[model samples]
Target: MRTRRRFLIAALAAGTAFALAGCETLNTVTGLLGNQLNFTQPQLQRYLNHSFPREFDKLGGLVSATLTNPRLSIPSGDNRLRLDFDIGVSALGARDVSRGHFALASRLRYNPATQGLHLDNPEILAVDVPGAGSLLSGGTRELVNTVLVEYARNEPVYRIDSDVLNRLPSGKRIGATDIEDGRVVVRLQ
Candidate 1:
């Protein structure tokens, strides 16, 4: 009886050690595979889609615009993302709403404080207000530009949760963000 009890304790100890070693090996493998996170074009598009339609009021509520139907794409080898969306503008209590299309192109930048990706150096490619030929001129264009600036500065295009980062080993954090093969790849270290 005494020998059986000693053997049982030894066996339990060995099993516990083996389980710990297996966990260590698993951790190493997870670290290797978790070095990067890939976000495809469709995933990015979905994120942007859910974020709109963003509404803005300018000129002391005289001009109001809503941005909707966001279409996002990551062009191959371009290292930039493009967003094309529809805009509806109403002015001075007018019942008629002017519809337009706006295309914006920008590079992506990572914000450490937010643990998210934001638009960087955004440039307006096109602003087409159909039937309103000169709408992209002067005040209208400036208002649109102002709205874009606010979006780029304040809103994150893609957010990385802390729990996701916690999956990495200690001392590892996102190191770089790049576009490759029409996907956004976030690399960690």
Candidate 2:
């Protein structure tokens, strides 16, 4: 009886260790980068590596953008803008693709001549990767390009109230916002 109890304890300990080892694999280095904006190039690369193909199908094209003026203000500032847009996908792969419904809040620098707010950087405002295994499979570059083009065309056009916005340099917002609708159409090569 005594030996059985000791064996049971040892087995439990071994199982715990194995479980921990498996968890380590899922510890994507991306997590260490955190959701802060102002990411290092490598950090940004990692985010784009995982994010683009996962969200979009094609690699190039202008995604449309719509700007919404703010009705209220946070302590950050009043020159905030809300952006809404979508990127087109040629093939969403066997897995499910999330309906593109993401928003990014940006601190805009207005160009008086252009009458537009410029995105200072590529900090992700929000993302909606619906579920696991939902990836664009034709090729990684193709998938990434699709999302990037959409992102480039639909750049945010408003300054965000930093107080409500997650200050993390790479923070990705998960909820929906009020902004005009836009679309990205992808063409196959």
Candidate 3:
């Protein structure tokens, strides 16, 4: 009886640990802006298929319009959309902000009758600003906000509310220019 009790306790502990470890794998937008965005293969695939392209058209277009030679490309995939683009900020006279890369994993949705496109849960996995060096932090929020606002105006399907933006760490007004990197990241999700 004593041996059986000990074995049951050991098994319960092991099982608890395994369950907790699995929970850690769930990824959220908060994780990405914090540079902690991690997703399982299936989660990543779902994000790519449902949310990527619309995000690309909205945010990606802003980045493209604001910068120079902003190349956007979507590669074909079985389940989701994969895109890689490069933009130079020099055209805006902010040479320091001119060079960056944006990568997106997302999926596409369409309404046959309306011929409309919808993207869901698209994640901006990486944004690399090589030229601005540290200054990238200064304008990252402005850039992100600009994209978000543009998204709101152009894409009715994207449900970004001012309340959600206000819930972000900065707590600054949605259009406020004081925003920095961490604030921008927190709102990205």
Any residue pairs clashing in model 1, and if so which?
Answer: none
Q: Judging by TM-score, tell me the better candidate of 2 and 3.
A: 3
Candidate 2, residue 182: Cα displacement in angstroms equals: 24
Task: Give candidate 3's whole-model lDDT.
Answer: 0.41
lDDT of 2 by residue, 1-189 (tens): 999999999999999999875553223223324532121222222323333322332334222112222121121332333343343233323433334444544433333343323443334455443431134444333343344455445533332224423332344442222112121111111
True-structure RMSD, every candidate: 11.6, 18.2, 16.3
Ranking by lDDT: 1, 3, 2
Model 3 bad stretches (over 4 Å): 1-78, 90-97, 111-114, 136-189
- Per residue, candidate 1 scores C-alpha lDDT tens digits across 1-189 of 999999999999999999976664454345447787777676677668788889988777877778899999887778889989898877775667889888988888888887778988889998887643333334556777888888888888877656666667678777778777787777887
- Best TM-score among the predictions, by candidate number: 1
- The estimated TM-scores of all candidates read 0.73, 0.29, 0.33
lDDT of 3 by residue, 5-87 (tens): 99999999999999865554333334434532333334433333454433222233333323322223344333444445454
Which candidate achieves the best lDDT against the true structure? 1
